[model samples]
Target: MRLAPDRRTLLLGLGAAGLAPRVLAQPRFVVPPLAPLRMEVDRITKITVCVRPFRAAGPRLDVERVAGKRVVHNYGHGGSGWSLSWGSAQIAAGKALEGGVKEVAVIGCGAIGLTTALTLLRAGAKVTIYAKDRAPYTRSARATGTWSPDSRVADAAKVDAAFPALYEQMARTSYAAFQTLLGLPGEPVAWTDRYTLFDGPDPGVTFPQRPTTVPDIRFFGVPLRNLAPHWNDLEPSQHPFPVARARHGTSMQFNVAELAHLLTSDFLLEGGRIETRTFNTPADLGRLKERVVVNCTGYGARALWRDETVIPVRGQITWLAPQPEVRYGLYYRHVNVLPRPDGIVVQYGGDSEMWGYGSEDETPDLAEAEASIRTIAPLFEAPKA
Candidate 1:
């Protein structure tokens, strides 16, 4: 029953032809190469410092009656103040409006205070923000702003059993809230591709660890990690970094200058008043006519409330004048560079979570700033032709 040699050859050729179409039917996807960053050292602009109000047991979101004033505490978000603001604001403002207080006062104008005030105003309550400093002048402005919901959010060992669920809720809510701000004027909030460059042969294991000098004590809430915007491992040719490996993810960044303006404008447009006033003690809050107040003093909470629980984690940013062509952010050798609409922020987190975990120093270091530029400069070297 065997076919003759010529007939058998013809039958094999037909089978090969059939396989060709199936192979060709499959599509190939290529990762587009990214634009090279302009990492020149001379591009440096300004440097600033901020103290994140880290607390072991997470943010203080409790209520107390002080001097006949119902105080809704909403401070100590650590590095996550900006990221978790809206969600936590919803909680804080809800407590503030519990008794149906028509006139409410917010004591602090950082991300938390402003958002809480806006949330209160939207809840149809007359809100006034009485703070010593507004957005730009506050320590919140000096932050290395990023959507870091759990960046030193809490020491897991120190948080309560219920805290993780609460943290996840806040992170999820804030993620949804930021989405509505996309495509707005000024590009107040937007997504940027972030590349993490590694120099080792095996870039090793899952979730892709970035090397750090200090122990990473920061709490990582793994529940909402699926909500991570984007993640893709890139072949060496797909990226311009001169590294052994590169991993990419989409990180949400806030153009603080624009974001602050938008939040401030929105509050006022909705009939919320912002007064330049400072509170030195709990008694000062009683002087105001509003019976309900939400305390969002951030690191200042340490002094005003005499609450020793609030720990300060210092963070500094070295800004370079913005380059319109640069649209991406990157991490290399533990230093981070993000090109924002306002400025190109360069921060050295080589020490990782503990870099400034307990520091409160607000002094600007020019040498340390220059060192960051040096660390990132090598990656942007003109690629060989």
Candidate 2:
């Protein structure tokens, strides 16, 4: 979408003052040549649902003694489990190691769990992951897999004054961890150009302003536009979409299929053990024999630990055949189209930013998938001159 007037002015002022010479010297935006998508309904290979374990006050990273066991809670990352897995896991593993435990049990085998287990292993702890499902089968696999460290991460009113700074630290730490995976075999993680498209100019929508007394929720008080290395405003003709304006940026997109396999493989090769089991209650953790446990159960913590605060934000995605020629992603209206190695993920983010809160339904709605596809199908049509 078109940049807000104030944002445009700020960016222009920076360029005019020669403060951002490298950015100002770059060529004006143009849509990268991409193959037109095959949007037929029959091309859909799978439809998956993910219930994000959203906590209003942000992810619960505290430690608690449960049944005489030191349980380091690491879940409730909301929509950022994959995005901030490593950093959050690092925190959890550190807590587990506080007791000088040589062995640890990691609950859940999702992205967060695996990362926690790996981090513990790296720290010389013998780790075992106990879970009902591993990656590719876990809810983490259903994610659209984009790097959005602060997407609905927490509620403004619920978070404490220190939450934003903590979030920034996690974001930066996770970003650095993911960078190490680049160019590795299977291309588990790679950068992709992303565009946020709008049908017209700015909608003039503004968030209900919060009082200054509260900590600023704007990701370390820095606008997201400025966070991306390549944030640019594109004219109508510069973007492939029929939308009148677009905000383009580069993001790290995860190939979850490859990533899961790679992580699991590495863990096994590194002497980490994974057990296929599910814990029905918190007491079940005591049977593991590990004195310390890191709970990366993700949404499962709701029932396992009876954590009512871990509300589920339901998300569904329709996967179409992969388009190797299409390397970028786009967000238009409420729909997001992300091209991954497995397939092109078409997801509905809903109307308002707070859409799908506390939704637990996991059934895939074909009608909803079709509706979302219809919204972006026109982008494949010949653009107007």
Each prediction's Cα lDDT score?
0.81, 0.81
User: Which runs of model 1 end up more than 4 angstroms from their true locations?
Assistant: 1-33, 200-220, 382-385
Residue 299 in candidate 1, Cα distance off native in Å: 0.5
Every model: Cα RMSD to truth? 8.0, 7.2
lDDT of 1 at 255: 85
TM-scores for the candidates: 0.87, 0.86
What is candidate 2's local distance difference test score?
Answer: 0.81
Q: Which candidate leads the pack in TM-score?
A: 1
Candidate 2: Cα lDDT at 325: 80
Tell me the tens digit of each residue's lDDT in model 1 across 1-385: 1222344455556667783222222222233555666666577788898888988899999999998899999999988999999999999998999976899999999999988999899999999999999979987777776888988788887888888888888888888888888889889898987888788322221222233333556565555767766677877646656678889888898888888889999999989999999888898888999999999999999999999888887777889888877788888777898888878899877455766766777888777777777777766663522
Query: How many clashes show up per model?
Result: 0, 0
